[model samples]
Target: MRRRNVLRACLILLAASQLPSPAQAEQIIRMSTTYTTADSGLLAYLLPMFEKRTGAEVKVVITGTGKALELAKHGEVDVSLTHARPAEDKLVAEGYGVKRHDVMYNDFILVGPANDPAGIKGGKDVIAAMKKIIAGKARFVSRGDNSGTDLIEKAYWKQIGDRPQAPAYISAGAGMGEALTMAADKEAYALTDRATFAAYKAKTGLVVAVEGDPKMFNPYGIIAVNPAKYPGVNYKGATQLIDWITSDEGQRAIAAFRVAGQQVFFPSAKVGR
Candidate 1:
């Protein structure tokens, strides 16, 4: 009986040795995405589906698109999902990102108080609307956080050759949601992604003042951090995520995410970045 017990114990030890350790047994994909995606609860809605299909857990770090790309540049995250086409292209050109795949998009809108202090309501031209807002010295809230929206706002100011130095022009130095909230609280105008704006519109009581401009189009792209640069990064998992997100199932999931019965983000996997 003693000999039989010893053999059973040895067999169990061998079986355990054959099994992978905890770290090897499970995969974790680190991702950095824009605050809009996270705040709109899209990630919350879609991550579970991916996890269910792939059995790999996702660790998310939410910030602006600029910061998300920065995380990818440092190999701090295995992948990034962000909008900001210029910045995304730069990262890929600089060799930090392996490839960029078109994911989804939502246009930016000028949202402000229903009173329309800037007289930009229903404006078809964003440049003209911004000029009106500046001329009237209407209150405007800027994200001022080197975010994608901030970059676009700065470009608008540059186009008009005027910076908002007036006291009415406030810099929130925060994300889209916070900037929109600040705008709502102060009754100031702000540019925000449609998805986030829709999510917060009722709560903030802000209305879309300007939209449908060609330049208002916002496109999101997904990039897998180059594994060659950082071998420690989960390249395999990142690829899996990117492929799955661009697949039919992923596009369908994106289309399915809606805020208040209104579809905010549109699927762009079929389109090019």
Candidate 2:
């Protein structure tokens, strides 16, 4: 009887080995995302849940939106999460992106010293606030790395037709977190994503000087790298991730994320499916 039991166990083990392993089999999906996403704590909260649900590992590469899109264009990543709409559209137009899906949105805010040297506090119009900053020559720190925030800042500058003069305009060539930090240290003004700014708010001591302008709206999108361009790209994993993130579950998770109990990112994607 004992021999028969042992034989049965061996047969069961053999059958289990023959069956397909986990669907992902611990496959790793390479993902690129903007620094704002990483610094805002969204990625940290969502990735682990996604990994647990899919049985797949995600390798995240954090950088500016331009760099993230470039990595996806080269197929160095399976998907990219970024906020630069024009550049993201260009990626798809150029055939490097398989598809783009709206992920989430927040708004850009002008953060400056508590003293309000530019006197932009309580302003509802972003353009007017920018004009005030430039006119006042208030010290301003710029994330000059061509990030999504930087692009928006440049557009505002173009609208006013004058760049912040030297000594007043300090280009940090860094991420949102660093730009905020520099702005705090220099007691300058900066344009930053609300989520990232909130995350670093306690440390930076910068106040939201201006907001509520429609032009300050910031949207994020996720793009799956084109498998046709790079045959080795993990298209399956990318699709799964995109589908999951756009699903009801993922949208709720994003909405639930907060900083200091204040919801930072609002779910903007179409729910379901």
Candidate 3:
């Protein structure tokens, strides 16, 4: 009977040893985010800290802003971080997202070859610079991926009332990094977020041709997928991530993220949230 008892205890201990440990059972939250955020290395810098604190890992889906929001809408991700305020607001209004919390911001800038084919170098007026590019028939690379940068570029062309013709206008239908590479290869002008441009500048050798336009202000927001709509979604984890990202520590992390010694992203989270 003592041997039987010892055997039962050994069996129980073996079963327990085979089960997953608490640390091995860490929760995973699916996050869909813009290409710029990932390409700029912000996630690499920030996510580990959050994971260490909460023991919840973030699985990032890197895509354009439009697709990022679409992932949230389709219940494919627990949360989304994207730029383009109008689209973000629309997602929240459509009940796909719980709420939109301001995260950070970086402006869009026109970048082109060092020779400045369009003659709009150092220009503050993005609209006028775009006009000059069109008028000069300079090759312009378009993301055409429906990204936040792409949407902003289309808006600029809409305001200009004309866009470059084909051959002069090349739609890459790719991410920011690839589009920038295409621009560099073609020696064409491209609109890009400052953070991504800073990250890729050395590799692409593209110079900023236009910047400092009020219309170029690009802000990012994080939204938790609505639990009411997608009951299976990790809404708790999503909210935890949203809250932590908008918190003081996350804001400071955003402020501290730099590319090539330049502060690329500015924290825009409201205080007391």
Candidate 4:
């Protein structure tokens, strides 16, 4: 009973005026997603198709993937789209999520000034490339927000033995685009997803120096919050949505997505990344 009240208050607080009005004859599905190019990345593809085919109004709550997952965990939203694999796996394994589906993939690339001060360019080994960045002590920008990118960056540093203290190293508790902009402003290096980097590259003036390394591969996964864990969740609608995303039409939409003739993200359903 207490939990029910808490959930109600949360929804009321977050409830958007954009939600369908009572007279609108529209169905709203609240979706949580990362503060990603999701505006142009997945939602730009899937939401339109879903709405066109189903006549439902999709209400999106844009935030970090971590915050999105938290919304799902609390039954604050119907679904979550995220790129953090280990976090997703933990949620699925712990019964907070159900029906995991591979939506798409893009590799993470280390972007630096065209000068390539760290000499990270053309380094096939990700660890070796990372080590060079550290050894050079060249200014490297980090998201540092416990975001998927930050999580992966920290994991990479952990894989290496001892890293220099995080002093001159800059931490931007901001989104990918903002962090990329920050990197560009300082003429520094940053790790970013290919899709966002490609979309914002021209505006930011950063160049991709290290890519094609297997470790740089980033895959996106969709999961419905398990109704059993958070009974307030819309299990039926969530299932329907997840089913559509993993289907051929949805997968094809993901593959068809491109910006300026550059295919930044690739479909990862039939094969592994």
Candidate 5:
């Protein structure tokens, strides 16, 4: 009987060892997002709460909106959050994404050195401001990475039918934060989302050079990659994050987030998808 009891205990231990470990069983979802969302400290502020509530971990890949959507297109990520609306619609229309949910919004602003070499400070017209920069041949830093901000900047130049010449137009080919730092370092003008500008305001010493332009309105959206296209993706986990982020609680949290003692992103979740 003693031998039998010992054998039984050993069997129990072997069975336990065969079971999956806690970490291995834990749910995880991969997300690709814009640099602005990450740099503005929004993800850092909200992701922890999500992990605690759902017992799931979110692996984030930070990149420009264009690249973020590209990752989703390849099914490399379970979800994507980006600021380019037209691109987001295209992704869904092409059936790469399940659906798009309105996440939040913030306006883009033109920022430059305090001295305002372009003489565009306090202007509400972005095109007018760009014209001033071109007229003065003021150094203008550009992300030049085909990012959403870059697209907008290029569009403004297209609208004006002019751009700063090569020497004056510095294509940093970097992210928003880095472009802003480059702008500051070069005492140049650059267009940026307000949230990132707010976060880097003190560090960059770049003041808002132009704002309040209706054309500068920027909106963000979140979409889960289609599981049909990528069977390996964690669709259930992605849906959980999507539903949670658009829920009332999540919208409230977004609304409450602030930088430099001022709210930067405003919640715009319609709350159903």
Candidate 6:
């Protein structure tokens, strides 16, 4: 089916939700994502599709990856979709989450002011390039939050074995977009996922300085909270949402997602052959 037809159908089903019976009204699933639904027009199509199919209304909360994982740690939400791998691994190992599965992958790029002050644009090694930025004491902004990007940034810091100018390094405990804005304002260097970076690059005036180092690959995962750890958890509904998202149906919907004809996320779960 065409995207328009599919979206139209979802809109109709969601509109009917306003008149749903008591049973329908009681079925809801709270979903949390690091990125806002408004970041992608595809969200306008997804929220309703899931609701119509399972009679589970999706309540969306947008927060930084750190807080989103914390919400899961505390059993504050039913489902989570985020791109941070190390944090997700920690969450699962600690018995707070389960049903881990790879969903998508995007690259991370080191973007900096267009002046090329650190001359990091053509650096073959990302860590070496980072060392140069630190040696130069050039301004470097960090997402600081335990976001996947932040986790990776710290890992690279360890790799280089030197702290960038402490006072020069600004840790913005905010979302990816906000961090990019600050980086632009200060003409500083920051690492960002290609999807989010591309979404805001034009307005932020930041240019990609480093990429394809084999270490900047960003992979996203989806999972549910382990009900055994929290009895009140909606394990059944959470299972349903995961099954739907990884199903052929949901995979197809994701692969078809595009912004200005550019594919931002490559679906890990490919639809039927």
Candidate whose lDDT is highest: 3
- Please write out the lDDT profile of model 5 over residues 67-92, one tens digit for every residue: 99999999999999999999999999
Q: List the residue pairs that clash in candidate 2.
A: none
lDDT of 6 by residue, 1-273 (tens): 699999999999998877857565347676678763335454676667888888787777787677888898899887788877878888999999985777777777899999978989967588888998998889999988887778889999997777686778999988788899999999999988777777788899999999888998877777798888887767777788888877888877777777656776777854343
> Each model's TM-score, in the order given?
0.89, 0.90, 0.91, 0.86, 0.90, 0.83
Clashes of each: 0, 0, 0, 0, 0, 0
Please provide, for model 4 over 183-268, each residue's C-alpha lDDT reduced to its tens digit, 9 standing for 90 to 100.
99888888888888887889988988888889888888888888888776666666777677777777778778887678877776
Question: For candidate 4, what is the total of clashing residue pairs?
Answer: 0
Q: In model 3, which runs have C-alpha deviations exceeding 4 angstroms?
A: 1-26
Score each candidate by Cα lDDT: 0.90, 0.91, 0.93, 0.79, 0.92, 0.80
TM-score of 5: 0.90
Model 6, runs deviating above 4 Å: 1-26, 36-45, 270-273
Cα deviation in Å at residue 179, candidate 4? 0.4
Tens digit of per-residue lDDT, candidate 2, span 1-273 = 999999999999999999746564427789999899988898999999898998888899998888899899998999999999999999999999988999899999988999999899999899898899888989999999988888889988998899889999999999999999999999999999999998999998989999899999999999999989998888989999999888898999999999878899999898864
lDDT: the better of candidates 3 and 4: 3
Clashing pairs in 4: none
For model 1, the stretches where C-alpha displacement exceeds 4 angstroms are 1-26, 271-273
Clashing pairs in 1: none
Summarize candidate 3's per-residue lDDT along 165-230 as a digit string, tens digits.
Answer: 999999999999999999999999999999989999999999999989998999999999999999
Model 6 lDDT, residue 88, Cα:
86
Clashing pairs in 6: none
- In terms of TM-score, the best-performing candidate is 3
Native-to-model Cα distance after best TM-score fit, residue 241 in candidate 4, in Å: 1.7
C-alpha lDDT of residue 105 in model 1: 87
- Residue 185 displacement (Å), model 6: 0.8
